[model samples]
Target: MPEHGHKTPHLQEHLLNIPVPDYAPELRQLVFDYTLQLADTSLILGHRLSEWCGHGPILEQDLAMANIALDLIGETRSLYQYAATLEGKGRTEDDLAYLRSAVEYKNPLLVEQPNGDFGDTVMRQFLFDGFHYFLLKALKHSSDQGLSAIAAKSFKEASYHIKWSSEWVIRLGDGTEESKHRMEKAVGNLWMYSGELFMMTDTEKQLLEAGILPDYTSIKQQWDEHVAKVFSEATLEVPQQVYMQQGGKMGKHSEHLGYILTELQYLQRTYPGLEW
Candidate 1:
């Protein structure tokens, strides 16, 4: 939060600190789309965790969720700032974040899904963090220097995030009867959305061709191995057969996103150009 009546430093000044290298003009749109995808996922999931700020099961866990939310929102700001630079449209990161229609956001379906109970939220975060931890590691090797830099910085936070969430998943899932029941319900609620993370669009395909990203197969392998190990410890059953939802990466989203944006964009939409 900003102090009343004191001007905060401009966001663009911070963005200037990021070192983006020269790239072919053909790569501009590709990078913009890819960066937006990453930013949107982080932003939506950050917002979801923020809903837990004062509502966690305990005080320490409350602070933990807040810190993780801040970590994700921090990553989102860098990615959105980078995407705005790529667009060359005079759009600021605020504009990209606040003014876009829900249809324009490229976050995966898994991220934008609502955070349910504490157990549900933990499951959601663990599943997404599992994928995110590996994806950032892969992105650190990108041909695009800017993406690589952002991924490297974000990967540090992600490592802790996964550890935190997975520990909770195990603690709850392997706990007493009621706790284990909630964890099982959470797995059923969120597992279907997990598969969409691996589904690729043309933007991902183009980036893969240019070595800006690794195959989703590889990331999925790492995610599956880690998830399986944790689940075994937790005594939770992995879903056997499931139909996966798709299309959020390419702007087709669940019904939930429209409602999320209504609240998320309300402050900016009501008071355009106002910032703390």
Candidate 2:
């Protein structure tokens, strides 16, 4: 296993050894975009979870949320590092993370949505975790070895996240009348955003063709099964099919993302290269 902190030499070596075909430039660009999508989701969702740093409903839950946020931010750093290298633009991971405009981010809108209540946060995490679990599982076999390495490392964390969030979903949904009501509301409100997870953008399509990205169709079916099983156990109803939300992957986002960026980018933008 790669060490938690510091650069992973093996990952760098794997990236360097990636067999480039004739259209290397185009391939690199597509991979860079795909990587940014990964990084942006983790980065944005990490920030959202960090908002609960000292505000979790209980002490243990507080610590768990914070630790999960740290894990997500760590994953974001690894992804952004690879993405920067792929871009060949002399940009650091910090540059790609903290310096981007709201419109430049490629995260799904589901991640950027505000953490509402504990029920809301857990439902959001559960939905994303379900999809992320399968996505990372598939990416572990990617032809791009660097991505495979990152996916392999991140898969462990995603597994824990899925387990934790799914348990919370069942707990809250089956707990009390109020808790069940809140969980149901959270599910309904967030269902529209979930569809965007399976919608392939052009970048993903290109990477899929090149064997650099996984086929999301099968992943979506797996996500549905996992979600249905959990919801059934919780005695909660999955929201009815509706027109699903879109566009966050294409740089179009809800108004909420702007507020997130304002806080996230403020110190970096104001200080112009400040470091901790």
Candidate 3:
């Protein structure tokens, strides 16, 4: 029997059984919260990256970034699909992605930050991609089959994302003196926000203990090593800033996400569940 009274018809036939462990209500809430945030993060970031479809610094880079954007979007769809299942709602992935307000979104502010220049975009991606790679590595063993499968596939994709973003980081950081300076500033600007990626709440603790997920702290070490190596190769200095923005995990987003959501949700809101 499915635990927690959660029926997973479409999922059960395709996945192995993963029994839910004993946990307090708060811990379960945390799991749901974390999962929601993960999905929202991918969705919002994918949308932002898609903005660069034709505006890349070069045709090759433009295409590369666009390809990455497509992957993120695809990943976002998978995540939201699973999240809807977890929520036990009939809502489709499109409903969650297109209809949510900014305050309802759980994506970190870093991914939504403006893309100032090629260096800035690469720097943002470098930081986020590094963290994503590490997170997916741990998620590959999740007790939740839907979540685990998504992470397993995403892990492979993230390898490429890490490679692609890291290459750009190095190219801009070590290319021209101007490029290096810009890349350095981008890193500094984005550094403060990196801490949020590894912050653990009670939900994560429970998941880790249940052998459903890996500890974020353990993954942090690997993330740091990978990021440091890339920055070293790029000839960029990592910033030492400690003060950073927060509240993304709690559905508090920057002002930009509102505008973006407005644009994205316009047709959906006006049409009220109309589909082609």
Q: Which is the leading candidate under TM-score?
A: 1
At residue 187, give the lDDT of candidate 3: 77
Full-model lDDT for every candidate: 0.90, 0.89, 0.78
lDDT tens per residue, model 2, 1-276: 657787745533323333333347878888888889999999899999999999999999999999889888878888888888777779988899889998899999999999999999999999999999999999999988768878898899999999999999999999999999999999888989999999999999988988888889999999999999999999999888678999999999999999999999899999999977
Q: What would the per-residue lDDT of candidate 1 be over residues 1-276, giving only the tens digit for each residue?
A: 888998986655446355555768778888899999999999999998998989888999999999999899989999999988888789988999999998899999998888889999999999999999999998998878788888999999999999999999999989999999999999999999999998888989988998888999999999999999999989999898899888899899999999889999999999988878
Q: With candidate 2 superimposed using the best TM-score fit, by how many Å does residue 174's alpha carbon deviate from the native?
A: 1.0
TM-score between model 2 and native: 0.92
For model 1, the superposed segments whose C-alpha errors exceed 4 Å read 1-16
Per-residue alpha-carbon lDDT of model 3 for 1-276, expressed as tens digits? 679989766632333233343446665555656677788888777777888888987899888888888788778777776666566568777888888778888788888888888888888888899889988987888766666788988889899999998998888888998998898789777887788777765566667776777888888899889888988998877666478787776667778888888887889999997877
Which is the winner by TM-score between candidate 1 and candidate 2?
A: 1
The 10 consecutive residues of candidate 1 with the worst lDDT sum are 11-20
Each candidate structure's TM-score, on Cα atoms with residue i matched to residue i, is 0.93, 0.92, 0.87
Model 2, which residues run further than 4 Å from truth? 1-23
Q: What's the residue-level lDDT of 118 in candidate 3?
A: 81
